[model samples]
Target chain A: MKNFGGHVLFLDRADINTDEIIPAKYLTEIAREALQPYLLESLTLDGFDPKRDIPGKQVVISRANFGCGSSREHAPWALEVNGIRLVIAESFARIFRQNMFNCGLLVVELPCDTIARLFTDYARGETFATADVARGVIQIRTGTKAEEISFRLSDFDRQLVEAGGWLEYADARY
Target chain B: MGQTVAEKIFETHVVDRPAEDVWVIRLDAVLCHEITTPTAILDLMRLGKDRVFDPSRIKAVIDHVTPAKDSNTATQGKVLREWARRHHITDFFDIGRNGVCHALFPEKGFIRPGYAVIMGDSHTCTDGAFGAFTPGVGTTDLAVGILKGVCAFRRPQTMKITLTGELPQGVFAKDVILSVIGRIGVDGATNRIVEFDGPVVQRMNMEARMTLCNMTVEAGGTCGICYADAITADYLWEHIRGEYPDKAAAAADFRKWWPDPDAVYEKTIVHDVSGLEPVTTFGQKPDNVRPVREMEGTPIDQVFIGSCTNGRMDDLRSAARVLAGRKVHPHVRGIVCPATTKIFSEALEEGLIRVFTDAGFCVTNPTCGPCLGMSTGVLAEGEVCASTSNRNFNDRMGRGGRVHLMSPATAAASAIAGHITNSELYKA
Candidate 1:
């Protein structure tokens, strides 16, 4: 089984695109690790600086349509190399969601109302989330308050997660 | 239950049913380009598994930054070239024959109705214009498809978008798609296959259908399909003539892939576009669209008239019609790139290249350079451009550069006026 728990970074914006996640200019680079320093470098969110905000963050909490542009896997690879493995959003673009699972990362989709409430309650303070895949619940808490949110994963996605990605899964099956 | 077109395609291609909704599908084609395929090749090499399942089913190209901008890009192209040669992939298009993968593959008649196709580029859905079940995949899935000829997918729901009326004058397929994206938000069709039909689609040519389907990703759609009809058969006549007795027979055979009349759709949207005007994007998102009249006179520093979205022969002719007796503005720089070498030659033979050159526009070889900020026309900081390509995300064409998406005609008119202007003014 796999689990995700860490300092939550709240990006309160909708339609964060692949170009903003990892710009198209750096796509020529051959290795995934080379994409680390450029993650979210083109993002124009108000009051969000990638240099300052990306450090010490292990999870991302964002608005709807996270990763909406290009189908480049560099976006998720950038996040993985930076040691951030979990993303919580109201919704996600189709290709981005599949890429995350193919790389053994987890993206949790919540209702729009629940995402709005989470932002209302935790956007101002230092918040943390522990995703317990076995328990089917995510515990979001600040220093003084706490809430438990439930999410579901499909059987195939769970299999991909347990196998540590598609390559390993194909190794056993194919 | 009646199946949608996507469901029928999935049913036909299913190799295994791994889970309730997950189907391991056998892919009929795999498209590769320089930017994404090199990573997959490296990964396969690292794992001691560097072989393709079927060389004939693979189509490779060096399109993203052709004739490479730097040593890094050149090495990426080298890796793909070596891999293709080693695998005996004869369909690989090198520098001289290269074009945008989506436009090139369809023009060659490599896609067919009900066939399953996948690529590492988002616009792979452009092939859905031929009624193929095409979706963009990451490197992992792409590598698997290249090796084992299969990938997995969840059963997709269908969203029926019935386009009702004929497009108004000066409004092309680009405007129709932009208007659809504007009505539905960016995420409106997430996890769904958009099936576009009704009178308007039935009359559109293959190039126009491709323009509509190419931007399906912008609305978060997995694929956008048009039922194969006489138009599709006509486009594929040269390639399919040997297999069929006549064009009508081939079209009749392709009609079997259409969705049943009582097909179940997750949602249905209707749009009457007869009164629709030319539209453009105001913000960075593709869905941040408005009518051209709303954002008129927005000064632009550059104009680009080519990409997978609107870089076909019809797109070039439309722009040439507008620029026939005009000149590019003194302050605005203009660039025109045909989508393929074949398109370039066709435009040259049609005297369209002369119209562009005589109007002070710089026409270059077919490349996807300026569309993605890779090369050829990178903008300076704080500069704005009127573009005919898809995706206006922040810094898409350059750092701190703004891109307003429009049709080629509008882009040509904007180039002449040095600002965002509607193409209707130049129409005779």
Candidate 2:
């Protein structure tokens, strides 16, 4: 399993549904590559352009229920295509979490305090973090400051995400 | 130890492992819609697997954005049709043949009791109305099911919701669920199986029961299941088998399981609904539900009545009763979508379509258009819509539009009043 880390794009909302991740308008496009520019398309209202903002970050940090509403795999596809490899949120909608695992996007569920701290640190201009899939720990780094938070993952989910996704995990098994 | 219905289904299908430890279980049925199947087929092609493990067990329908809203979706639909045809998937339903995937699956007798059903749509939990263990999956999971006839699962804890007392005349199943969601909050039942029990659930007709299970996902539940009883048998016999007839014998055997009285539950909640009022959502979450009377006078620019949530016969009939002789308000643009072709035909036969059309409402064919902001009655910027469909997320019906989620009766009432209001106050 490859460890990945990058700058974080912080979304403060509690329930960022799939529709907001990739609006239904983009769903007509069948290819994952075609879904690239629409990741968090609705966030444009908050002045975050999918093309401009997504490329600047490879890890997304959000509050609870980070992927609620609709079982659209396009949500993860859009994020993955936009170069988002790791998502750290307080929680996630069930199917969205499943889709993330299936499509090779790593999701870590942290405590609300941990997520709040991430937001606080990011707001204070500290926006870089690294996720060590091998260690089950996320190293939070800012200039001259360092912190770490561990997350819980079941054996099944850890194995799937570690293997690069459900498809890879399944193929390896069967 | 007594196990819930979901536990039993899991126990029955656990693949080559102990029931409690089983991570993979064989699926009795798998369903997909046009929106998800295109990608699923792509995965299948990538896997170099041409045939589904069990074609008959796989049901694919083109209901979401059906009649193809645009050229892109139309092309995708054509591709799905061609793929289903090539695979000889027997239960595939075309645009005119099906309405919404959730509604049509159970209506076609594809979801029977004791089945472990999976669909590539979140509302697949709707089949839990028949005591089935259903969890909505994504495209890859659907592909997995197609190839292996099984998918991985984590055993979920159970939440038992016991409903006592009868619904008042003006109240409906939509109200019942909305009230529950309002109490529990949106993620209250996250990753849990919610088992509905007690008198109210037992007395609810199949369509009403389906409505309860339909919104289970709104509460973040994996499934909302009701025990199968004579009512379930009667509904399948009367509504499904009576139409198909070849499935009459099969329907007889559909009523196979229920949770035991002593089944262990992680949480047990009791709700008495004898005085429950019609409910509607005021904000972006399904759990943001409020009584219709409380939100009355909130102006609405559009009203939508239909979806897997409440587009069934009873829901439309209730809406029709409210709009029987009334005209829709000039400020409101209303659309009523029957959930299935069968329901559309039946409503047309019963003259419900005439009522909607006479009231200045556009009654379209059975499709899930606009319910998720795909196509059809999308709301323009700053427009407020009263919708019967589930989910009131921001821009859910369209970008920058606000949605008030309500029962069909409330949506119909709002259409007539030009604002979100209660059906009981509307004059015939």
CA RMSD per model (angstroms): 1.1, 2.5
Regions more than 4 Å wrong, model 1? A1-3
> Where does the lowest 10-residue lDDT sum fall in candidate 1 chain B?
B419-428
Whole-model Cα lDDT of every candidate shown, in order: 0.92, 0.84
Candidate 2: tens digits of C-alpha lDDT, residues B1-428: 88878878878887744233336888998887888888888777877875678888888889888788678899889878988888889888886788798889888878878989898889998999988999998988888787778888777689999999989978988999999999998889987899998999988999999999999999989889998777777667645555544554545455457776788999999999999988898878899987887898999999999999999999999999999999999988989999999999999999999999999999888888879888889888999999988889878889999988888988998899998888998746
Using TM-score as the measure, the top candidate is 1
Give Cα distance to truth, residue B132, candidate 2, Å.
Answer: 0.4
Cα lDDT tens digits, model 1, A11-46, are: 999999999999999999989999999999999889
Cα deviation at A89, candidate 1, in Å, is 0.9
True interface contacts reproduced, per candidate:
0.83, 0.55
Tell me each candidate's TM-score.
Answer: 0.98, 0.95
- Tell how far residue A43 is off in model 2, in angstroms: 3.7
Work out candidate 1's RMSD over C-alphas. 1.1
Model 1 achieves a DockQ score of 0.84
Residue pairs in collision within model 2: none
What's the lDDT for candidate 2? 0.84
